[model samples]
Target: MDIIQLLEVLKPAKDVVTVQIASQKDPLTPWFDLAKAVLPAAATAFVAWRAMNRSHRQFEITSTRQAAEFDKNLAQQTKALRVQTQIATEIEIKKEECRNVRDTCAQYLSLALESNRYKNDFDLASEYILKGNTQFIEKRNVAHENYLESSRKTLSARMLLMTYLNPETSPSFFESIKNVDTSLVSSAPNFGGVVGKCLAECRMYIEKKQAEISTIATE
Candidate 1:
């Protein structure tokens, strides 16, 4: 109604308008909101990248350890294989040597038998000479020469066996061979039993060496 009353009502309205203006958003409010939203996502992405890197490093370490273990196992297998091969080779060589010895011993026995046959012929011719048969003198000389040659060959074969025989490893075989040698050279020689025993011992020795070779191959 009057100017003073209208001024009081208008003052209240002006104060309300001032408060609303002060509370209103600034011009940079949208940019601040965008930063807030982007910061959380960027932090999450950084954390994920770190986790992936750590996993990759762990994988690398595991792969390296596995590779090293594989190499060690392979080296050990190769060494074992090499050792087996070496042992097998040695066994084969020894087997061959045993065969040689067996063959040579048989040859010696054959020569000894031939020498005994020639000795009989020489003795028969000597008996004729003692009975005053002049024609038997040349035959006796020839038989004597043949007997000496056969004996020499037998001795040579026996010497060859001495090089191959091992008394320590093949004691029974060595003893059997000794008995055969003595029997063949003795005045009243017994050939049948001693010859059989020597050959049997040779067979057993060869069989034992063969078994060793088989074991090495399997391993």
Candidate 2:
């Protein structure tokens, strides 16, 4: 039963005892009996109150612990988000750097290919000059050998004259011609014009290759 109902029942019983004592001749016996009965009831009510108080304290402690755990979890999640953001920023920076490096390498490779083409043309011209020189040295027909030697000499002279006249020209062309002897062009017919045409073709080839390389570099 509720505390109020139990108290009501106890009150009527106490009132009946009081009435009985008033009617009796012994007053000490009634007082002693009332004290003994009321003391035990008060003790039981105090125990019940203590048990409720302990349960309320335990609930408060449990709620505080749960709130602390939630805060700890939230803090950990925030730290992880910060770490992930930093990592993503670093990765983006590295990707940009890699793109720049790749572009630079592509430009360099394009230039290198043009340079290789020029070198190949230079090597071919040098080979032709060497072959002409060897044919001139072999004296099969004196006039034909003289003509071949004259052609070789004209090639050498044109290369030298271009170098002397256009000193600021590309060293790649000048270097290719510098090793040849220029004394064999004694009286060869139209050899100078032929050599000039060959040099012009070489210049045109280099210019074309350079233009192509420039386009690639820009891209």
Once superposed on the true structure, which residue ranges of model 1 sit more than 4 Å away at CA?
A: 1-52, 187-189, 207-219
lDDT of 1 by residue, 94-180 (tens): 778868977987897788778767777888899999999979999999998998999899889878887887799889988987787
Candidates in order, TM-scores: namely 0.64, 0.32
**What does candidate 2's lDDT look like per residue over 113-157, in tens digits?**
333333344444556557785553334344354445445445544
lDDT of each prediction vs. the true structure? 0.82, 0.51
- Give me the displacement of residue 30 in model 2, in angstroms: 5.8
- Best candidate, TM-score-wise? 1
Best by lDDT: 1
